[model samples]
Target: MSLTKDGPTPPPATARRGFLDVRDLVVHFFTDDGVVNAVDGLSFSVEPGRTLGIVGESGSGKSVTSLSIMGLNRGRGTKISGEIWLEGQELISASTEEIRALRGSKMAMIFQDPLSAMHPFFSIGAQISEAYRVHNDVSKKAARVRTIELLDRVGIPSPNTRVDDYPHQFSGGMRQRAMIAMALSCDPRLLIADEPTTALDVTVQAQILDLLRDLQKEFNSAIVLITHDLGVIAEATDEVLVMYAGRGVEYGPVKELFAAPEHPYTWGLLQSMTRLDRKDQDRLRPVLGSPPSLIHVPSGCPFHPRCPYDAQAAPASREIRPNLIETTPGHQVACHLEPAERQRIFREEVSPGL
Candidate 1:
């Protein structure tokens, strides 16, 4: 269950690569203000039995990307384009019926807030039973038995009794576990967990992460873990995708990215994390400046306005957007800084501080 120190490449491009492949995905919201480009040409792949963490500040399109992949943006004033290939099947152009058929059976999502995601009126057991029945043609009694089994498997105490409790009856951690149970009821090949550990105590968060890793190993499911927590990524994910202004600014293996992040935005995030290893440090640093507006992102790189090196950055950094170019065999970044400058800063300055 240990994550790799080196960034592992998805199966080669010549190969089909993975169970889920997202290519040049663009998602735009037509608000009265203007077109808010929530996700602009983002792309990534998730192999079965591996976890990919998508980290970013609020409104960086991390949630939007997951929603787009889940097809949850369809009726939410969002226009989605680009390819979403799941297990050799093209999902973007698939019919609504097709997507619906696949959603709970082949793919499922564990939303951030379990209280909101679950139905207050129904018992947790009833909800889980319904989910199981949707993709399966089992009798109601059989579905209820399956639900109880799932509750027990996810470590819910007194599964036979607690399964009958409502969402409000469970603690935050328990509710989150219930959601995971419901998501796994169908035995999906892909599972997208959006901030699964948010609002939980650190101890509970660690437990939840361990549970997910164990379940991933059992099911061999490709996981898309969306969160702003670096600790969670460091603990569980095989790969990291750092998003800024609706685009991926840095992507690579979690260990490699942490050891030598190439983007300034990534440097900011590392500096911002509260380090339990550095008890001698007096205070934690935070990324300077607010996140950019999606409606009117910066002219060039969206991070230029807050970048410490902006004044001295190359002229094109202020005029043109940077492409996500690979720096190593598996690591890649989208930044205007020259490779030499990025290396110098990470080695001489940023690495020591973090």
Candidate 2:
């Protein structure tokens, strides 16, 4: 995906343009302590044919950013700025009515927890059909047909009988597949999945990820996947956005980022992934320290406090916040130190074997 301005409009038509284009998006919440910058100056684009992963730790603005795009954070004392274009329409300034119309039809979200997303009282069929009926002026029978099809499409077995089951009746993995079915009820152009496989076991997680990939190919919908798991990003996304302290510290192709991570934060993330060397296998080396509070972030680099490279014998790594500079053709990094210097420190002082 060549990200040239001339390639496509901010939000092209559903048939002609890209699925989503977000530019300089800012979401701030008013709290007693102060303003919390949940999403600060984030920019990215998602074409209909590909998936974009927003990976970071909790409070890294992954979920908040996706919510902002879906118009789900309105009227919650949240102030938003910047442009969010969906299928050529600007969602930022769109009326509540307009956004409501677009919610499950043109755009839909599959939340992390299926138990919470589904209504306890409503049967799976009822909830799924309701999603379709809310968007389209179809009869209940037609919506039921669509609902059953979606359930089957999402790999749910016995869709005919299971559709009548309640949320609690289904297992964890089944409930998640049901949620994906509901989100895809209207054949949405964009699917925003917020940690879709968070609480599931490893086997279930792999299944869900595979299901998502297959669905994307079938529906050709643009996906915005928000997750803390780098492995998920590696498997499912075409592009990766490494966010830190509400800002996009790095963004590029998934393979390139994983192969040669430019940002120190990204490097930290890669290093933290679990490694297997032999039959015994070793435990994962987790990233050190928690993220800073959004209310009172650090002055220079928000990640400077926890970054190991900062403590090394390098002056440029400690003093100033590095701008996200284009180090390579498509690789971008926000480090004051040169690429050669950072790579040297990362290979020598940080992860010598990597």
Per-residue error for 138 in candidate 2, Å, reads 1.1
List, residue by residue over 127-228, the lDDT tens digit for candidate 1.
999999999999999999999999999999989999889999999999999999999999999999999998788899999999999999999999999999
lDDT of each: 0.88, 0.83
Q: Which segments of candidate 1 are over 4 A away from where they belong?
A: 1-17, 279-282
**Tens digits of per-residue lDDT for model 2 on 28-47?**
99988899999877777899
On TM-score, the leading prediction is 1
Each prediction's TM-score versus the true structure: 0.94, 0.91
In model 2, which residue pairs have backbone atoms overlapping below 3 Å? 12-17
Best candidate, lDDT: 1
Model 1: what TM-score?
A: 0.94
Steric clash count of candidate 1: 0
For each candidate, how many residue pairs have backbone atoms clashing (under 3 Å)? 0, 1
